[model samples]
Target chain A: MLGRLNHIAIAVPDLAAASATYRNTLGTRPTAPQVLPEHGVTVVFIDVGNTKIELLEPLGADSPIAAFLAKNPSGGMHHVCYEVANIIAARDHLKSEGARILGDGEPKIGAHGKPVLFLHPKDFNGTLIELEQE
Target chain B: MLGRLNHIAIAVPDLAAASATYRNTLGTRPTAPQVLPEHGVTVVFIDVGNTKIELLEPLGADSPIAAFLAKNPSGGMHHVCYEVANIIAARDHLKSEGARILGDGEPKIGAHGKPVLFLHPKDFNGTLIELEQE
Candidate 1:
């Protein structure tokens, strides 16, 4: 179950350029860029009221974002992050319902020190969804 | 610029079936079914805390969702609706940044009497976005 919209991730070829475009268009600047070495990507956060727009860019060929961009080509939205009160309970509940968790047990620390886990796209009709707990 | 996340639309093949799946898995029932005749589709709303998950199914072949579902047959996330204080200002600002508006002038009343306007997916890197002012 989803609690709140933590952030919406958008994949772009260039993070700075994309961030600039969004800032100029939305009249808001991103907080800062953070590199997630585990995910092989960098993320920029733009606050949109109660929600956030995460801009992602692949670091290299082995990056997951790179693989996704290769398939999408033109670049597009990558995934949606839903905030949950309890990550373990939410993961277990989804798993019980035949949803596959991309992560095993406990969630890993993601940007902003939040615990996060990803759900396999197969279980979500080809949408990559992340569950984050505060 | 944005007030809150009104809803995140997910393009699905069947409204009833998708709604059932979500209800069973999420342990929550949808608010109700609402049809937007002009949009040529029916929408089911599943509240996710401060956000909403909108399951959309095309009503006919001419429906916009029909064409979208045709391309992404596996089905996936669609657009992200950002709530705004003034629809006209939002639309005008986005347009000034070279974003094309899919709708004409004044906002049209959607499902819940909320004024809404759509922005062309071209400006958003293939992601259709809706701006709603309550």
Candidate 2:
């Protein structure tokens, strides 16, 4: 069901500093920060050949990553996304396997404009997993 | 410079259960666990097309991930490994940029049998970064 590893999302307290670290220290060119009001994050994508590293900063008080930043002030790996051929089928299979889907168990338009659903971290070795339809 | 992401390492408290979750729930085949005593880890690799997800369980009392698991009982993203053309040069460049290299600041043989060095999380947005010579 899983295809390519889509991207690894890192929630950072300071987006510019994180982006600069990747750009200057790691020598990777990071895209300009783009604010996603719906997702409540300002994201910058760093292409690392096969996959991407997404630097996310909370956009507002109700931002999804605001709590994560509070818990991890310096920032941390937030989630890993995997591409899937058919998200509905994948979700169904995961449900049948006793895997817990996050939210209302419905796929939402993700940061990449793709249908995506998050799985419970406890059900996934404490890793927040995002399944994106490719 | 950073190349392809070598793998995303997730430290799991229960290796078998984590492997089963990836294999069954995610519908991805996981390689059999391989114990690396030198690294103090038992690892299973889940191929996600472009890169791999490395599931690491502590091998002994002094395992590097033991402390991480102690803090996160359920486990969590331990580190992100990125390939480098020349590790020594990468280390030198990172140092020039004031990035703190972990441990003795020398590249050591990583789980994949490649020379690798870990950068301080505080220097990289609180994300442990591994640079592997490829």
Candidate 3:
């Protein structure tokens, strides 16, 4: 059900520094940073021709990324997103096979203004997985 | 310049079990496992339409993934590979901008029979990055 690799999300302790690295340093001309209060993250997207690199920073202490940064300090890879033809179908299929959908098992509007759902890290080899509607 | 995302690699404690999870559980048939002695890793690629999910397991105690697993225990996202039109140019540009390429600053033949170079995790917001020749 996965279509294409949509984006690889990284949680960064310092969003500005990480954004500058991809923009001024790497010359990717990243998109302007955005704050998603619903998700508790400030995000920026660096285009890589066919895909994107998402840099995320916690918006508040209760943010999940904040918890991740508390443990990792320097931050790290947070999740990988893949585009799916139909996210609801994909979620249903994964759920039927015993995969754990994160949160309330419902899709949320993501940074790209698309329906997205996160899968539990445990079911995905300790790597958080995200499914974005294509 | 970075092209498309080639793959997202996840380090796993057990290659067989991880491979089975992707195959039987997720229903994404993966490629046959390949052992890269030089890198001290055994890997499998699960096709996801436009990109692949690379599952990596340490072949030896000295493998980089082994060290990551030592810290994470359950294993996790290892690195991400992006395709570049000309890897040498990409490497040279990144170097001029002061990005620290890992190892001896030289490209090595990766599992896909292409020139690949790894960048330091420190230079990329604590996430290891790989550049592969497209």
Question: Whose TM-score is greatest here?
Answer: 2
DockQ of each: 0.60, 0.89, 0.63
- The complex in candidate 1 yields a DockQ of 0.60
Better of 1 and 2 by DockQ: 2
Q: Per-prediction interface RMSD?
A: 2.0, 0.7, 1.8
Local lDDT at B120 for model 2: 96
Which whole-number lDDT from 0 to 100 does residue B34 have in model 1?
82
- Cα lDDT tens digits for candidate 3, B21-126: 7876566888889989888899998888777889999997688788888887778998888888888898899998899999898899988899999998888888
Looking at model 2, the pairs that clash are: none
Ranking by DockQ: 2, 3, 1
> What lDDT is reached at residue B81 by model 2?
95
lDDT of each: 0.79, 0.93, 0.86
Name the candidate, 1 or 2, with the larger lDDT value. Answer: 2
Query: Which parts of model 1 are misplaced by more than 4 Å?
Result: A103-106, B103-106
The share of true interface contacts that also appear in candidate 2 amounts to 0.90
Q: What's the count of clashing pairs in each model shown?
A: 0, 0, 0
Candidate 1 lDDT, B22-129, residue by residue in tens: 787656678677887777889898877767888888886688788778888767888888888888899889878887888575688876678898887666666677
- TM-score (C-alpha) between model 2 and the true structure: 0.99
Candidate 2 lDDT over residue span B4-70, tens digit each: 9999999999999998888888889999999999889999998889999999999988999999999
